[model samples]
Target chain A: MSTMAFLKRSPWILHYDASSCNGCDIEVLACLTPLYDVERFGIINTGNPKHADILMITGGINELNRAVVRNLYEQMPEPKVVVAIGICAATGGIFRECYNIAGGVDKIIPVDVYVPGCAARPEMIIDGVVTALSILEEKRAKMTGAAQIKDDARQAAGETT
Target chain B: MTVNEEQTTIGVALEDLTREVKALQTDGYRLVQIGCTDTGGAYEVNYSFDRGYQYRNLRLTVGPETEVPSISDIYWGAFVYENEMHDLFGIPVNGINIDFKGTFIKTAEKYPFSVTRRGGDQCRNA
Candidate 1:
């Protein structure tokens, strides 16, 4: 029995489009359709960052939205995994030639999983989320250990003060 | 007889664009979109507007050094277009109601749509 075994069972997701063309976005939505129903794995598409266990980003980060991406990432508590959902998110797709297009989601934030494709298929998106779940569980284990160490140090400091 | 839905293009001098846009605004026309194209060190600016059903365009050629007057006075909504023109095309614009200060189409690089390419001299923001 793992310390945070329940945490790995139901990991919520927060979907964001850095600045994509909506192609990958539709595919991500398709994963929620009856055909895919990623929810069977307990992956919930959430709108709130507080409830998000996985941050799924689907576009190249522009300078304007760079701050916005950082803000959402910072809001999500520790032990979270970030999944770059498509080619643009993994590496700014067609817009890479354009003057303003930045490189990838990892250029702005840390990415645990990278799904490759112009518009990644629904199955691949579901697969990426499944991979993200494992990463989230790993991070959660590390985070719990770090929190306990910090609490012990703080308690020691309190005894002296 | 019904009027064709085709858009008509009008070429005007940079000096006369303000006057033409003002007249069109007074005549109940709306400023649609402004498209800027860079060709051989010159900016080919196309200003589109629609009155009721028909759409008209005003075309003008200007150098990158010249500052174009903001059409937001005529149509407040034009501020967005004018701001985009300034941000992308590096077209100097004055007096916008709500200026994004060249943040409209936020790109990785600055003045991305400008005629001044990577080798040439960079613009003010660069």
Candidate 2:
């Protein structure tokens, strides 16, 4: 299913607050406000992981939220993009040395874009989401290309038979 | 706007913890917070209470392996902190109303805040 056209028009995003101090989460919400208007980029914030094409995560993964984060990532369909917002999600920030923190989101799942800030600014978060949109398109293109290659190989085998 | 906040700390024996907490409850003091500190060989547990503008802390210093009685019976909401103390500091809290049994704040290491960690490896050289 080549949903690249649809994804470009409206890519759904799921925002997960792993262990953030609400600083980054507030900034993410700010992006949605009229001042930033993140939705202008054809991005819609979603609640269900299954419906999400982009996983925007704030804060570093911890023991408790590790499994939850992994499960959410797995539930997202292929050609998904992960955006690690803020210093915490990128490098565990100040909580890296803390006992519970398991470090960046990339430790558990693959991250495509990283927005670096203590509490990432609204503009930065919007930029990260826009960057994730391009990555998501790239992943979709790869998925379709892989399918095309497999189909071509099958067709060649049939012709030989 | 500045307000005068009076604070006092009273050392309470482990055995008398329940009695003192119960007295504070009867006196209509609201349970403010429960905090634990890893003080070398011992764990200092402080239970703070607030009434009007006055704040009082019941401090209990017990051995690392000592079992601390749960104040949840009096404050009811104290189970949250009691479970945290048990999970984070390795302090065995007895008779908690809702006990998670060391699963409260799941950490990478068991009792990570404890001075003597379970494996005794993290801060040995630090």
Candidate 3:
């Protein structure tokens, strides 16, 4: 089996509440409960950025948390996915015009999926995670394909020598 | 025992602020909060205190440039509100126990709540 198979089997998620009113954060938590049971897919909720495969951000980017969001995004490994879990993370929602809000999660980091809701429902969050898994696999495939091209170039150079 | 009480607000002169806050402290009142409102370029600062479920407020209207003395010496935790007031309204607060120097709220625009809100982008290291 390829590494992509393992990637699909287990995907670690990191949830960050950039500037949410706790409405989206609560829904994100609801996804973890037995009623939703996202863990059934072998998706684990992680706190450390380095261990996260999907960044599930729940709020808009604010001046105070912009640096924090950037730091967390940078710390995550390559070929990772980001899911904007609410309208706030999608376009800063109602706070887009606020003085402090910089904008959505995409303003600070690349977002692979956007789940739209004032407070995203747990079902929607699960659906977003499922969507993020596909994006993560695509990114992983692209990375491996590039490596294969590099290896072939090296082999061709060896044959010429 | 009855716990009914009415909220009382008394206007105070800016210079008499420290003296008035000290009196409240002596009377065994705990500082509830310090809130500032921008009232047409000037500032209305309200000092809220509570003693036995009774809410009392001291209101001070000061010019935009007036320096407000910090009541942190009396309440100790008043520095939080003082710093917030200064950061949001560009109000000058003197002698805070711990001053963040306009870094209290980490807003994108400095004094964003001020009538004349001015300043460049601000970002603190995470």
Candidate 4:
């Protein structure tokens, strides 16, 4: 089913905190505040992974949470976008030196948008969400186009036979 | 919230950890946190117990094959820190109340902070 129209109006996000300090987490919350009000962009933050079109992850990947991150990413349906918010999620930041740190979110999963900051600013996070929405749209378009091409090829083969 | 206060330190062997921790518990001190610092051949594991403003730090210098007994029996909260020691330093901190085992860290390198890491490895022996 083409849920592209539904996804366009409401691209819900699942926020996952891997191993970051509260700095990046607080910034994410800031986006929900009246001042930032990210809902204007047709965005909503949801806890459930199944409901999320975008995955907003903050914090560096560690060994234990690597599987957790992967599971959440896999649970989200296709045409999903991953937004790695903060320096930690983008590159592991200072935590990279720590023995337990695996690295950035990209190390475990594909990331479409990266919002860089020690603790990413709310504005940057909003921008990242917008960017992710665009990427999600692009992916949906590509997916539908590929399906159309496949259907056309099957039809032509049946006609020839 | 920074304060300058005198902190007491007591050196205890790994075997004596459980007994000493029990004694501190008897004195009405709360188990704060256990810290493990890598010291090449050995690990200096510090257990910080507090009663009000005063702090008493119990330090244990343990090496490979030395199993630091978990004092989780005395302080139920000791498991978290002990599990950390188990995951990183490979100290084999046994009898943990909430055993995470090696599940504490999600890193590429196993026992990355452990002194048991092979000699002359790029990061180790540096």
TM-score to true structure, per model: 0.82, 0.90, 0.93, 0.82
Q: After superposition, how far is residue A72 of candidate 3 from its true place, in Å?
A: 1.7
Model 2, A77-117: lDDT tens digits are: 88899999999999999989987788999999999999999
TM-score of 1: 0.82
DockQ of 3: 0.86
Ranking 1 against 4 by lDDT, winner: 4
Clashing pairs in 3: none
- Model 2: lDDT equals 0.87
Q: DockQ score for model 2, please?
A: 0.77
Higher-TM-score candidate among 2 and 3?
3
| Residue B35 of model 1, lDDT score | 86
lDDT (Cα, tens digit) per residue for candidate 3, span A84-150: 9889999999889998888899998889899999989998898888888888888888988999999
**Deviation of model 2 at B32, angstroms:** 0.9
DockQ of each: 0.60, 0.77, 0.86, 0.50
lDDT of 1 at A65: 83
Residue pairs with colliding backbones in model 4 are A62-B106, A63-B106, A63-B107, A64-B105, A64-B106
The segments of candidate 4 whose C-alpha lies over 4 angstroms from its true place after superposition are A1-3, A151-161, B1-4, B13-16, B119-126
Q: Which candidate has the top score in DockQ? A: 3
What digit string (tens of lDDT, one per residue) describes model 1 on residues A1-161?
Answer: 27558658778889998889999999988897788987777778899999998898998987788899999999998888899988889889888766667779999789999998888999898888888877877787788788888999999999999
What are the Cα lDDT values of the candidates? 0.83, 0.87, 0.87, 0.84
As for candidate 1, its clashing pairs are: none
Model 4, A1-161: lDDT tens per residue?
A: 45557758578889999999989898998897789987777778899999889999999998678999999999998879999999999999989887768789999999999999998999899889878878988998899899999999999999999
Q: List, residue by residue over B1-126, the lDDT tens digit for candidate 1.
A: 786777899899978988999999888888889889998899999999997669999999898788777778788888888878877777878778788777666556666777875423343332
